[model samples]
Target: MNLLEYLNQNYLMLVPALWVLGFALKQTPAIPNWMIIWVLLFVSITVGSLTFGFSYEGLINGITAAGVAVLGHQMVKQALLGSGSRKK
Candidate 1:
């Protein structure tokens, strides 16, 4: 019932849930893109610590999870929109 044990058991679910939250927030124009990233990062860390019990490991995991979500979002955006290509 410890935090580490809970994390080990539910990491897969927790990580994706954070990603989905970030992606959804990205659709809102009320906030700037940079703010969105930072907000998601903060939320990820806060959620991880609060839900799993606060610890250094939880903070690191939260940062890693947020980074993964951002990377995934950018990858998908570039892939589907062909945004990586440039025309001159």
Candidate 2:
């Protein structure tokens, strides 16, 4: 599938995955759900008009990358926060 079609078929799973990443950052994060929805709408209208076969590898890659980025951000946030604390 092309980039647009790939995005459309998988965007549902992608947006929420992005949101979870934003939530984990617990700071300022870009790419909110509203933007994601807009992207999906655009893709659906344009590229998503055509349907294609499913791709397990694409799905797995998208989720795994998003998940890893989220975990890494969370780890950094925790470490930074922990370092700034005072102990009794």
Candidate 3:
């Protein structure tokens, strides 16, 4: 099942935006590794609310966007890194 189906079409753009923001956060010295997700979520929520007004659907879409961005990053990362087993 595509998790993205639950998100609004308008919110789809936010996924990539969040990903880029997360990447920037990772590169920053002050952000720290653990806080990156929270930062992304906060930005996503704010963006959603601003776009659609404050409401349950807006909040849910924000959450879904953040989730998709993080999940996509991790999936790609795992594919490239493998399961921690390297053959020399």
Candidate 4:
């Protein structure tokens, strides 16, 4: 298989996995929403730039991915922790 095909295959798997991972990260102690968003955003952008060769959309895609990840993490966290309030 060619490099592009190999990358596309992995990207398909990774996108969903990243969502799961973002939620997992939320379970950790003191995992700020901002940090999670930034990290995921940076990773997605880096991947897009390297994989699809998006020159300008690199920043935009990165921001969008990060927002999506953060929102997903927040939803998962709320589901698990009950409206984001810490259980006493």
lDDT of 1 by residue, 1-88 (tens): 2333334443445567877777687788887877887988898888778888788878877777677667777778788989458676
TM-scores, in order shown?
Answer: 0.73, 0.37, 0.92, 0.53
RMSD of each: 5.7, 10.3, 2.3, 8.0
lDDT comparing candidate 2 with the true structure:
0.46
* Per-structure clash totals for the candidates: 0, 0, 0, 0
Ten contiguous residues with the weakest lDDT in model 2:
44-53
What lDDT tens digits, residue by residue, belong to model 3 across residues 1-88? 7989999999999999998999999999998899999999999999999988999999999999999999999999989999786777
lDDT string for model 2 (1-88, tens) is 2333434444445445554645653443566644543443343333222333335654444544454434555567788989667577
Q: What's the lDDT for candidate 1?
A: 0.72
Evaluate model 3: give its TM-score.
0.92
**How many pairs of residues in model 3 come into backbone collision?**
0
Candidate 2 pairs with clashing backbones:
none
lDDT of each: 0.72, 0.46, 0.93, 0.61
Give candidate 1 regions above 4 Å deviation: 1-9, 83-87
TM-score of 2: 0.37
Deviation of model 2 at 4, angstroms: 26
What residue runs in model 4 are displaced by over 4 Å at the alpha carbon? 1-15, 20-36, 83-88
Candidate 3 scores a C-alpha RMSD against the true structure in Å of 2.3
Query: Which of the predicted structures, 2 or 3, would earn the higher TM-score when compared with the native?
Result: 3
Best by TM-score: 3
